[model samples]
Target: MVRYVVIGGGIVGLATAHRITIDQPDATVVVLEKEPRVAAHQTGHNSGVIHAGVYYKPGSLKAGMCRAGQASMLEFCAEHGIDARVTGKLIVATDAAELPRLRALHERSVANGLPVDLIDGDQAREYEPHVAAVAALHVASTGIVDYAEVCRVLADLVTKGGGEVRLGARVTGLRRDGATTVVETTGGAFVADRLVNCAGLHADRIARLAGLTPSARIIPFRGEYYELRADRRDLVRGLIYPVPDPQFPFLGVHLTRMVDGSVHAGPNAVLALAREGYGWGRVKPRDIVDEVAWPGLWRLARRHWAYGLTEVRRSLSRKRFAASLARLVPGITTADIVRSGAGVRAQAIAADGALVDDFLIEQAPGQVHVLNAPSPAATSSLEIAKHIVARFDE
Candidate 1:
């Protein structure tokens, strides 16, 4: 039997198993994933940005891990022959009303130890020749990479270190077996001395299956993106973003340059009726019922109904979505964009309607469960795994 079983074959789980193999060479470790490959969900579907600890509150796990993760990620990418680049990002304010919030965000970035440059409209334009802004904050460290590649590297190291990665292994139930745990999966039964759960979309459900109550439920938020037509790609030289609404969790639509050298201009954040719902073409009745029946969700809607309504409008109407994206990249129009793809963010909401703004991990005598890991998770995966193993020492 393996000494440890890391559930969820996403980057975190793979990283966790890799760490165990490195530290506990004699202990057998295995990672069980439901999909046929690693990083099939949040990790693979990410925007691949190396977040610079800009948006997080200082001293929290998000801030600490993201800061450490940025360094670690750059180092790993350099050492592992990954094609990651430090393409700097801009947080732009297109109107005077947003300038104050932009300044506050810059302050927060500085507090989090990120070097930020405050610039006027002219300086902002210099960073991205086509970007629009009354003022902006240039964060030089924010970069982009294919996280799917990072996950692959972690899996390779884990397996070569004597850890096993079992794909197509859908875990169905969990029960304590004497001093060990029996993880029942669709592939077969696997027993281990300890368990770690990092299931992204199904995190809460998996926690409840293990007899733990995660204070929040994983509410899926679908971010629909659009790619600029090849002819308009030059219109965006680099990343262009808007001053996010401080009251809400979603960062508004903006322009982003992908690692593939293509420019994507979109991502309207809207509530997804289904957890894995990628398109308006897909829906799960149970997912919708669960969301609508939650009092906390209703409370959240009441607090931001107007914004929510607008998000739906932008989602259903490409013209409105294009206009929102045009706030930062004025060259874009409805005709200049086409449907690219969508990524589902596993946003965890509390019973009290508050968004869990930081990473949440819980531990029992023989298990650890990551309940909520928000944005920058992909950037912070390796660092997060290091932290997870360190917790065992505590």
Candidate 2:
């Protein structure tokens, strides 16, 4: 029997394993997760937004995958009795300069073949009354779902489909023998006919272990968020976003109505000192050292120093974060928010200081490595898995 190994049991890894088992029933699959359980990193700590493929360029990998993955995720949720819905989101343009960007976004959405409604000032207000904007693009299919729960269900599906999911199994090394790829982990060595590296944070390292030189490096961008205090939750009826600056990759701070009825805001893009750092207190010295030593880090810093500094300032000041929130919803105040949580974005950067805007992958003799899968990756997890498998087949 053919045996396959999937590293990283986050959403991407779990979903990949799930697809493999479903497609090849008789094949043996093993999922190795470094953490004690699944979804410990990006998947567990994401915005939980089921993206509607609005922010990407038409025909880009992100656009295609998010659109298809949105539908597949909903179907998988319904089949597994998961909680996911199309609560919809509004991308608001509050000022004159942002208006053109908003219009361009609407056109891009249409070009991507996504369902969208272009709303005027009054029409936008009708959808989200408290949301402040001159015009907006309403993506009716966007929604929120608990990705951690979905990861659990995917783990269960993999097991039921006769696959083994090994947790706390950190991959330490890789070697290709005559016919099988040897994966050396903290637990032991496992040999498989093929390997898949879906490590969200450490994907590049995993690729190098398998003897493939990936061109890009994973730079961590921490996205800090705050939850509106219970008393002020009503300020947001649903998701509210800004007309993201085209120059930078981040979509700016905005309000998101979570599935649990609470509202969250702010996710400023700051360089993360630690790959898994979720707070000011969670910095990892090794991760910090590695980032500083990378040329790509220096390049990005030199180019976006001012923006990066601004994000750092916002990270330290809750009042500043609330001010950004006020741009989208004037009703929000500093007192209305409590430091909810934060997530690290694994942004892939090139050697020349350019941010990798599209999905990047590298393949070796016996392994497939996902170098970059940020932003809507949680939304595009299902489709990405299928794409990875297709590449492996080729």
Candidate 3:
């Protein structure tokens, strides 16, 4: 039996641990989480949208994993009696300027074999009456669920498989001895045959701890959100997204109808002061120093300063945030929004200044590091686990 030690208690790590035990019933597994509870970082703070492989390049892992993962996620949710819904999504082009990108996304969607269709403004409005669009891409497979709940269920599955999840166990170091890998955590040390690094926010640091020099550095970007007021929640029927700007890596602010029946709007992406900084006030001095010290950050900023300025403006002004959202849904206004929590994304940037666009998994002597897993990661967790397990088996 292969003994496994998975770092981080997010959905990906939990899924990996659970899949390992499932594939090898007699295998021993241990999941180490820094927080008292699971999904404390990106997994819990996410918008909870199950992406439909629309935005990613065709043939990329994101596209394939998303398609397969969406199915697996729904199946898993159904089997576990979790609340998950295929609310569908519309990627609307508000004006002629966005038509080219919209068509491009449609082509990618079709190439990826996703269930999608190009619709005119009338059809778009039929799906979401509040949206203002000249054209739209209707993705039937898009869905929403509380991913944190999914993490909880995964932890239970891991436990049921004879695995142990140690809470408040922060991994401080990693060392290799013969064929065994020793993981040093705050709670204690655990030795195993293999180590899987799924530490979403601190993945890079974890790689270094394992004596691997990762090619990319993680830069945290805080996506601030606002919830629609109870009375104004009717403005969004389901997920309504804008044709994202090609220059920016972020999916522009969109209106998402969550599983709990509330609508969320405007996740303006801006540089977070800390790795887990959910708000502007939650700053870490070391994080700021590291960010400023990274040349890749400056290179990225210099390239996209104008777009970054817009995001900063929206982040600071409620009216500006609502106005950006209004471009997609005309009925939305600043008053219709209320303060909501933010999610910090661990976006990886290479030394050459380019942002890593796809999922990156690096394998060394006895370790595997998940370097970049941004949006759709929660949606693709199960499929990713399968791929990682395949690598281990090979």
Candidate 4:
């Protein structure tokens, strides 16, 4: 039987291993996660929005995978008895300047084969009564779910299929002995005929450990959020987003009504001090050194210093953050929200200083490395698993 070792227990890794168990039932699949539980990092800390292929470029991997994955995710939830609701979304244009971009986004969403409608402010108000907008794109497929629960189910399925999920197994080193790979971890050493790296924030470092020079370096960007006060939850019915700034990868601060009926708002993206940095106080010297050493980080900062500064400012000031959110929902005020948890995004930057927009996966003789997967990754987890497993055939 083929022995496979998968690193990281995030949704993608667990989903990938679960797919293997289904496709290659006889294969011995093992998942190694440093954290004590699955979905501890990006998977658990996200906004839980099931993306509907609204923002991705037409014909891109993100657009295709997200579109297909949304259907698969909903199906999986149904089969597993998970709570997933299709509450739909509104991409509002608060100002006239944003109207053109909103219209362009509508056209792009149409090109991506999404069922989206460009509606006027009056029509937009019908969907979200409190939202302020001159125009909006109604994306009916966007939804929300508890992804941590999904990952838990995926882990259970893998174990039920005779696979093992080794938690608290932090990988320390990697070496090859002919066709076999020896993975040394904190838990114990394991041998694998094939290795998959889905290490999220630390993926690039894991690639280097496997002796592969990845095209880009993983830079963590902390997204800070605030949730609306319990009494003020009625201000947002579903999801309310702004016409995203096309220059950056961040979707801008908006409001999302989570599955638990709480409205979360304001996730301003700032350069994280460490890979898993969730707040300003959490910092690691090595992560800082790594960012400084990478030429791409410097180049990226030079190109978008102003945008970066704005994000930093927003991160520091709650009032500023609330103001940005007010543009989408006029009823929201600084007093209406409280500081919520944060998530760090593992953004990949190329040597040329370009932000890797799409999902990036690379392959070697007996290994696969997921270099960059952010945002819609949770939504596309199942499809990403299929895509990764299909690589074995190639």
- Candidate number with greatest TM-score: 4
Q: Provide the overall lDDT of each model, using Cα atoms, as 2-decimal numbers.
A: 0.86, 0.89, 0.92, 0.94
What CA RMSD would candidate 4 show?
0.7
Question: Which digits, one per residue and each the tens of the lDDT, describe model 3 over residues 248-355?
Answer: 668989889999899988688999999999988999998888788888999998998998898898999999998988999888888999989999999999887789
Candidate numbers sorted by TM-score from highest down: 4, 3, 2, 1
Indicate whether candidate 1 or candidate 2 has the larger TM-score: 2
Better of 1 and 3 by TM-score: 3
Estimate the overall C-alpha local distance difference test score of candidate 3. Answer: 0.92
Candidate of highest lDDT? 4
Give candidate 4 regions above 4 Å deviation: none
Candidate 4 residue-wise lDDT at 220? 98
- The TM-score, computed over Cα atoms with residue i paired to residue i, of candidate 1 is 0.97
**Model 1 Cα lDDT, one tens digit per residue, 191-267:** 87788989988888888888887788888888888889998898987778788887766667877788898887667
Off by over 4 Å in 1: none
Cα shift from native, residue 25, model 3 (Å): 1.2
Summing lDDT over every window of 10 consecutive residues in candidate 1, give the lowest-scoring window. Answer: 247-256
Clashes of 3: 0
Error of 2 at 260 (Å): 1.0
TM-scores for all candidates?
A: 0.97, 0.98, 0.98, 0.99
